[model samples]
Target: MIPANFTYHKASSVQDAIALSQKLGEEAKYMSGGHSLLPMMKLRFATPEHIIDISKIDGLSYIKEEGEILRIGALTTQSEMEYNTLLRRDYPIFMDAIKLTADPSVRNAGTIGGNIAHGDAANDQPALMLAMRATIIAEGTEGQKVIPIDDFFHGFYMTALEPSDVLVEIQLPKKKKGSGGAYHKVERKVGDYATAGVAVHVVLDDSGICQEIGIGLTNVSAAPMRLDRGEAVLKGKKITDDLIAQVGTIASEDSEPTSDLRGSEAYKRSILNTITQRMIRLAIERAQH
Candidate 1:
């Protein structure tokens, strides 16, 4: 299927982009990497009257350190993020998720903000960002606002972004020395959506009691959900194999999955259980010296 006929507009600045969106109203769709929007457009899942291309916007495509936070511009490609020395050193979890996304060609083109802003439950970063407790920054006709990644994902193919808004940057806090995170996903094939994915961040005190546990799950529900209830049970608890296994058990109780070509509701739930425990342990191992 081909997308319906649409007009195209390119904006070279954030203000210009926002203004164009307002001019185009709800009939306009913003284009970043075009990986997400184009496929949907081809399927006619989305048909907008105007395509406002923001790729030309300057200063919206770099990874830079801002005090304790890493401010990732919305247009920074996945490949850039994957190979970034700062990201790899400070937050390898982001790098882990970046490597699992799409494939070489896709990574060369897909942008971090596009992945997060699309709010696709199957995408890597939504869940990873949730687990990292990152902050998402959005700008619009109204003003700029910072939203926690947990709240940014409203549901599948949905986000907290207002129609007039563009996600400009992601601000991730500095990782403490004893903290670490990584993502693991089960994909049926290369470039396929995840069957089940888990992102875990573990923080250990000097004495090694688990100071914090952040967990995020994908494709087991309508959204990439942070496993807050489950993580709560592990935080401050001694990291035990049994306790982590119990977490895998509790994860199943919270999910709402559907049977499809990918797998049965039962299968997704089971995989979700298996991977959550495994990734948490991996995160723990990485956190240690």
Candidate 2:
């Protein structure tokens, strides 16, 4: 299907993008790599009268460390994140998650902001961002504000971004000395979204008790779910097989799966339990040495 006829605008600066979005209102859309929006337009799932291309908005593509935060500009491509040595050394979970999204072509072109702004529950990055407690910066006519990753995605294909807002950057807390992170997925095919997946960040004290835990489950609900019960089961306790088994069950029980081409809700739930446990174990191993 052909997308509805639309006009195009090129934004040379952050202010320009914000102003264009504000002026176009609900009928306008922002384009980065076009991986997320173009497909939707082709499918007629979304139609906009105007597309303001932010791809040439030069300053939005960068990776930098600011004090304790690792700042990633909105236009940073997935491939850049996937191959960034600093990111891999300091935050392996970020790399682990991007490796599971689409293919090399898509990764090379798709922007981190585009993926998060797309808000598809099946998209891998949102779950990872949620687990990492990342902050999203958005600029609008009123100036800039930050939103918690947990509150960013309102629902499937929906977000908290207003028509006038342009997501500017994503900032993640830097990795500490004794932390471990991993992201694991059970995809039907190489580039397919996870049938059930988990992204975990764990910090262990000297006693092997879980000091901090973040579990983000994908394709289990309308939004990425941070499993509190699952984390509660591991806090101040050894990550033994018994603990993993118990927490895995807690994670599974917290999921809200629906049947589709992926599998039945029961099947997805069972797989989520296993994946969650595996990801946490990987995180533990990475943390240990």
Candidate achieving the largest lDDT: 2
Which candidate has the highest TM-score of all? 1
State every prediction's TM-score relative to the real structure.
Answer: 0.97, 0.96
* Candidate 2: Cα lDDT at 103: 95
lDDT of 2 by residue, 82-174 (tens): 888888787888778888889999999999999888887788888788777789999977889899987888887889888878899999877
Reference-based lDDT, each prediction = 0.86, 0.87
For model 2, the superposed segments whose C-alpha errors exceed 4 Å read none
At residue 192, candidate 1 shows an lDDT of 81
lDDT score, candidate 2, position 216: 86
